[model samples]
Target: MIHQPPVHFLGKTLTGQPVQKQVRKLKDLDNIFLDQAAFSAADMNRVVYEVFSYLPVDEGTEGGLFFGMTHLYPGTVGQEFYMTKGHFHTIENRAEYYWCVEGEGMLLMMDKHRNTWAEQMQPGSLHYIDGYTAHRVANTGGGILSFGACWPSDAGHDYATIVKNGFSRRLLSVEGKPALV
Candidate 1:
């Protein structure tokens, strides 16, 4: 797949016309809280950002290649960076790949056993999230943090696990920079 920009931001390209797409809003993330003091259940209805998935060739297919973009707005809850609700693939054996197309952030990954890894992300940085690993993205930049990702269509997100237990570690904003907390 090519660049998956927001539908409203697209125009006709020389290759082909941009397909109309749906926007997935992820505003309710109180369940996946690491810093309880920072996240408030009353603010769960607040909109954080949105995701736009593009699968131009997948008419009715599953377990095939699908790519999309995640635009994370800049903000913070206390010292914690704004982040995505991390999850594992429900299919258990389907890996996913993420590439930072714009802005700067950090990818936090962990396994069922709590083995953790943190990677800094910026324009052109790439990361491979192995199967069974729960992953989340944190925006550390001053503006929007945009990243593109691809994975098998059948690798559904299992967010309940992460919501229930949370990640082994958390990403915090330390002096306006990302730090492991």
Candidate 2:
């Protein structure tokens, strides 16, 4: 098989070529937020976040790597902070890495046993997500929260599991500060 040519990127700014973009709108996360009323009353067309990925090889290709950037806008659905739709990898043994590149946030993680925890994310912070963990990112700051991620190309997302069970904890803004509830 022919291999992809070398690619370059601006690490700090997350700018690169041959990237695929996907935008996630408020309506796309129907049951993600804690406040149903707030979500219902909010603008469904509002963009919550966007993902830019540099997939050198087709997704789900074994032995290949996937790189991407997640840009979560600053906002809230009621008291809850804006967050990604958390997910587990279809290939449960697949691990991933996340690096905070442009903003402040929280890397929330939950294990298969439902135990949950979080790590503060800031520019230059790096995190390792274990294979058995399901993870989500929450923008807890006053500005857009952007981060870079790397994972095995074969580690397909298992969003259905998260949508079905949901995370054990929720990150909310209390008195203008981020709190895990």
The lDDT for every candidate, in the order shown, is 0.76, 0.91
lDDT of 2 by residue, 29-116 (tens): 9889889999999999999999988898888899999988899999999999899998999999999999998888999999999998
- Quality of model 1 by C-alpha lDDT: 0.76
lDDT of 1 by residue, 1-181 (tens): 7975444333211122353344333347765655666675336555556666666555335757776778788877777877888899888878999988888899999987998789999989999999989889998889888887888877888888888888888887878878886
Candidate 1 local Cα displacement, residue 126, angstroms: 1.0
Off by over 4 Å in 1: 1-27, 35-37, 41-46, 56-62
The number of the candidate with the highest lDDT is 2
Total clashing pairs in model 1: 0
Please tell me which predicted candidate would have the highest TM-score against the true structure.
2
